[model samples]
Target: MGNTYRRVLLKLSGEALMGDLSYGIDPAVVDAICAEIKDVVNTGVEVAVVVGGGNIFRGIKGAAAGMDRATADYIGMIATVMNAMTLQDSLERKGVQTRVLTAIEMQEVAEPYIRRRAIRHLEKGRVVIFGAGSGNPFFTTDTTAALRAAEISAEVVFKATKVDGIYDADPKVNPDARRFQTLTYSYALEKDLRVMDGTAIALCKDNNIPIMVFNLAVEGNIRRALMGEPIGTLVGGSCGIS
Candidate 1:
């Protein structure tokens, strides 16, 4: 397959980094993912990544458990930063040029998030990893991905998840759930498909950035998605649900 998009934002859930473990990142898994990223970079596609902190912590869950909402979110943001560092290290070890840019401004560990700098890094063939969730408490890494994708003029958002694509219902719970090859933003929002947070989906819709949700668990899926191999569901624009 040929590369259909020049630049793309990859959204990875932290839980995917856990691999077969119950918590924390798996070294082998991170290395494997970095290898895929290396392949994608070698193909001349500019890639920016936004990783979630769900494996380490969930802000909403913490808030529900009696922590202050803002504080919980801030904690979650830090977790994302940790994940970003781990990913950056793994990529660098694979001999792939990578940079970890954080919203929280921890200069000693990472560079602060700057739109121009990030785009420049991409132009220089460096993978830019955005961390710390917009540097705000209420927002999620998903929103960060959408915002960064727009600012960087990315062609699409590759949402890497455990499942292969968007389903009419939870596939794990319902064996008969149907997967959609393509879907409209309005339909997803109207049906509450949960492909992404409403805010994140709205941002992508407003910016006309198509989102491709695919399973990260499958080998070579990242490279396939980036190369437009049609491995998952495409959402946004006039693509009708199926």
Candidate 2:
């Protein structure tokens, strides 16, 4: 079988699972993602996921109201746990084996984050979902995705975004903006693209892991991107798409 990625770290924003709705989890949308993930698994790729909690709780929202950033971050982490549980339920109900590992020590609820254990689970064909966003303040889940992808030596960091790929400008705001089929990290930064936060980009660069930005809402996009099809912008060391 042709495989572009043997192992991948899927960075799913909570908002993606919300579909077109304004907030909270959307069952149909989440199911679609689970289906896509399962299809990828059938292709012999080991998947690890890092899901963000922006749909339920964004730390910045609390910080804007003078709440302590650290406290707000912890709240965000807990929200991620909720999302993880929901995802685990969705996947298992569909007959897939899954595990939710949290960064915080919640012995009764989920497994504590351990690099080797997580990797072993992936090697055994189990879907490992990582939540809780680094278990600390002053960091975003995007950074957590990069760190985890590197820790497990994932071939690519798949960022499931709302847009099809990284654009020179926000396609929604700018009708004339163009989507890049491939990109270099330096060019993305030089052009001031905002596909990911600065810290996340830094982590990927430091680890030499490429980031593939694609719209998760787009049907079959995830599987197509995983097979190395031309579906999104690939950015990082030696993307080989110049």
Candidate 3:
């Protein structure tokens, strides 16, 4: 718990912000996550969050139909901005210093995605939330998360999920699916593990940033992950899964 990660990229799925509600943003869930972030920020851990847009807009649903791919993706990016604004407001209301940086610029509300600016903000103990999903199409928030992690030079990418860790199969669907405490990148690939998409995994592996997939739905899991605890599936190069 002592300085294992000076900086971390926490990836939260849009679904995580849904909380007990049905759609859009849930203030309770956002506040809970911010509380966890504040706990680690007090520990001097620099936090950069990459948030998803599914809670408000699912681009895939539109792209799957006759919708133009770029247009759908643009809508998805806008959704991320809404989520960022919600989180930013909640964190600020909690007395936590926060910044919202978007890939697609919306200067009236937040700063543009400038790596140096982001690092500077982090140095000043401001939690940075990255929105807008890489400002392009044909890319999921997962891919954006990897890209930002590498850019921010985060030691680890914590992918907050519904499950505590990776399993050999869908544990929810398959009761016998074994949960792996750790896994090797090769095994994850050789076995076709669905922990992450191939593109996201490849980026993390290529950049040597270990990905910790843990269940954020569980109380305090985010803090545990930031503390570098062995609470999730750790995927990285040579280190395998842990």
Candidate 4:
């Protein structure tokens, strides 16, 4: 099937890379995700990724425990680069061209992030994995995903999470919590659904970028989402019934 999006940005948390492990990346899980990504790229859809660092270290948690916020965040940023490199290795092993661009300069390891260069790589059908969380301490990877999506003119942002979609309440805790197939940015923010944090959601809202939240654990979901399958909650613009 043809993809509905020409270019897309995928947001993945570091915890997602952990799979069922307690911490750190699980090679098997990264391989599976990369395989899915390779499949989408073969279909001629440009893909960019923004991965988080919660599994290795969370800056916020460190700060809460008395570490300097900026220092902790910088360390967190480095952790993201580690994740990006791992993803790049996996994708390349699958015979897919991939680039690891870091917000912070890492000449020996990866190329520094240049907006036009990143776009050019995407245009050439190479997967670009953006690491280091915007080169700033205060930003989250979610915000980076939104910012990069806008900068790259991605057609949509796919937020691959553990949950299938956004729920009225914690689906794990509330068996009856409802899932909205579609949601307006205002509603998601007003209700604080934590879809991608306030900054990320607002960035998407201002740019009119749609976000599709789906379960990454479900095999073939990335391809399904690209096909415009209604398997997740879409957030952006207006939804008549949501």
- All candidates' TM-scores? 0.98, 0.96, 0.96, 0.99
What would the per-residue lDDT of candidate 1 be over residues 168-225, giving only the tens digit for each residue? 9999999999999999999989999989999999999999999999999999999999
The global C-alpha lDDT for each of the candidates, from Candidate 1 onward, is 0.94, 0.88, 0.88, 0.94
Ranking by lDDT: 4, 1, 3, 2
How many clashes show up per model?
Answer: 0, 0, 7, 0
Residue runs of model 3 more than 4 Å from their true location after superposition? none
lDDT for model 2 comes to 0.88
- For candidate 4, the TM-score is 0.99
Off by over 4 Å in 2: 239-242
Which should have the higher TM-score, number 1 or number 3? 1
Cα lDDT tens digits for candidate 2, 59-127: 989999899999999999999888888888888888778999999989898999999999999999989
Candidate 4 structure lDDT: 0.94
Error (Å) of candidate 3 at residue 65 is 2.9
Candidate 1: count the clashes: 0
RMSD of each: 0.8, 1.4, 1.3, 0.7
Per residue, candidate 3 scores C-alpha lDDT tens digits across 21-124 of 78977788889998888889889999999999898888988889879988999999999989988888988888889999999989999999999999899889
Write the candidate numbers in order of decreasing TM-score: 4, 1, 3, 2
Worst ten in a row by lDDT for model 3: 233-242
